[model samples]
Structure formats: C-alpha cells, structure tokens
Target: MNRSSFRSVLYLAAILPFFFSDCKKSSSGPASGSGGNGYYTRFKMNGSSVEYDSQPFAGITLLKSDSLYTCVMVAYKDVNAGLKNAVTIIIYSANPIAANVGYNDPLKSRRSNGIMVPQTTIFWYDSTGTGYLTAGEFADNTGNTGIAGVIANAKLTITEMTSASVKGTFSGTVYRSDLARSAAITDGEFYLKRSQ
Candidate 1:
C-alpha cells in the first residue's frame, strides 16, 4: 500500500474506537431502576424546594474509600425539557454500621479517632442556568465574599440502610470558614435504591 494510504488507514483505526465508544450513554448516578416508585430525595434549601425524585436517573452507592465508607446519592431533577439539574450528596463514615432511624452524628470542625462528622459534602448543579451550590458554599451562606464558613452544629441520620437500599435524614448549621456568615439546613430526607 502507498504510504499515504497506510497512514490514512492507521488514522481511521485510531479514531474509530472513540467514535463507537462515545455512542454508549454514560451513567449519571448510582444503580437504581429508573422511575421506580421507591426512590426519592428531597429537601428545602434557602426556602425553596429541591427534589430528585425521577426514577432510573436517581440512585445510591456505598463504597469504601480507604478506611472510611463513602455513601453517595445523586438525584436528577428536571428543571426544563431536554435539560437536567442534579444534586449530589457524599458522606464519609468512620465505620460500616447501617445508618438507621434515629441514627445521628454530630459534625465537628476537626477529625477525631477516624470520625469526621460533617465530613459530608453536598453539591447542587443547575446544568441549564445558575451555578452550583457546593458543600463549601453551603457552609458560607453569610453573603460575605471574603470569608468562608466553619462547618458545625451539623447532624446527619440514616433512617434506613440495607445492601439493596438506603434511607436517611440530615440537618446542620455551617459558619463561614472566615466566620463571615452562616446557613441553616433542616428537614432533609432521602430514600434511594442501591445499585452497587
């Protein structure tokens, strides 16, 4: 074969895999049946209702990261047609104990004995318009541009947990890391099907 033809063949070989691979739809979150009547996670943020109730698109995952267990849930809430909004919650546990009802943990500023309460991070992403509300931003709700909040007075509860599903509630108060402002979160609950 001519050198030009050989080079063209090599280029196509390299590019074809990527083209085909891209056809697969990437999973948006944990493994749960889409549109199942069993999954829901909702809360009030800044006096507005934030919910991730769609099935198949919302799910939960529990995996160990180093010595700590990582529990994560992602909910896809439709804010518009053809566009999506998402809320992500990640919690770091010192142990694998099921977070069942009335299960509560205090969130402190420093870690102690492998336990870091308030070691959780929550993210709110509006893929269609407004920016995201990160764990740090939630901790810095005082309207001060120069200072961050110190996370404290936080409590998280897992109302139910199993290998196949998980349910929980959480609330807390966070002060800016700079001590500039603070935000309050209350009455939060989530029930998700475990895919992993």
Candidate 2:
C-alpha cells in the first residue's frame, strides 16, 4: 500500500480495538464536581448537536516521548447496529499540559510519526461512510473519497484539568474532498477521567 494509505490503516488499527475491547471501568468516577456521571462528549456539527453521555469507557491518556507529551482523549458511544463511531482529541506539547491552553496550529501541516494528524488534529469518525479530508489524503473504505476536519480552522482548549478528570472545548471545520463540502463544528466540549 502507498504511504498515505498505510498511515490510514495504521491509524485505524490503533483505535479499532477501543471499539471492540471490553474495557474495565476506572475506580474513580468523573472528575470531582464535574457533574453528570463524570463522562460526556458533546458538540455541534454543521449547526446540529451531536452528544454522547455516560459512555461505558472514555478517558484521557498521556503519551510520553523523550521530551514531548501528547495528551489523547477519546469518547465513543456503544456500537449500535454494528456501526462504529467516536471522537478523538490529541494535544501535543513539549511540557506538561495545563488548562486554558490551545494546541495544534491550523496554518501548519499536522504530522505525528510521519502520519497526517486528523482534522483539527481532533477527529470525528462514523462508519456510515463519508468523504472528507482530501488535503490530508484521508480516504474512506472505498479508498476513493473521505472526510476530515480542517486543522487550519480548528482549535482545542483545555478548560479544566484535575487529578481525576480533564475538561476541554474544541471547534473546527470539516470538509469532504470529493464533494467540496464543508461543515462547521462549534461548541465542542468534553469531560473525561484518566484512562486506567
């Protein structure tokens, strides 16, 4: 397979397990005083709101490199009718992450380990099939078209970070390369605990 295709496959392989794995619940509940079962991801896409709450498994993880740290937060709804979907937010930094900080630059091409980071570097996926992300070379199952949010128009900010949970907000634009269609993502917010 070509490089881009290979990267796409690798990305899928890494996250696919989260969809199928029988994850154990964390001992602690949602961040203290955060409210609502302590786990939720909600946002608006193209003016419509898409929300998921009380996910069976959702949390933030820290990936450490020599001197860099990537905070990855993932939230997904249980598979319904065999469809798999989720949203992921990754924050890369040279130092420990803090609240009120924004990560990812829209003006620069986002790459990690030689792979293009998902739209906004924060991504949303649905199995029903849509073609977005032409600029980033992301394609759908058919390999002909795909969809990805725009990094240049995207931003994610950590609103709160505590020992038990993390809260954040994000916004961006997503594009379908095949149709030249675009959608706005606004009022995105999430609260999750440290992945166990």
lDDT of 2 by residue, 15-134 (tens): 643543444344366522223665777888778888755342333334433334556665655433122455656555555677887764432222445443432355565555342322
Instruction: Give per-model CA RMSD.
Output: 13.7, 7.3
Candidate 1 per-residue C-alpha lDDT over 127-161 given as tens digits, one digit per residue, 9 for 90 to 100: 45222222322232222223233333344567777
Candidate 2 error regions (>4 Å):
1-36, 54-66, 79-83, 107-120, 127-151, 176-180
Error of 2 at 16 (Å): 6.7
- Clash total of candidate 1: 14
Show the lowest summed lDDT stretch of 10 residues, model 1: 16-25
- Using all chains and alpha carbons, the TM-scores for the candidates as numbered come to 0.54, 0.63
lDDT of 2 at 158: 82
Which candidate gets the maximum TM-score versus the true structure?
A: 2
* CA shift of 91, model 2, Å: 1.4
**Segments of candidate 1 deviating more than 4 angstroms:** 1-36, 55-65, 79-84, 101-118, 127-154, 172-185
Write down the lDDT that model 1 would get: 0.46
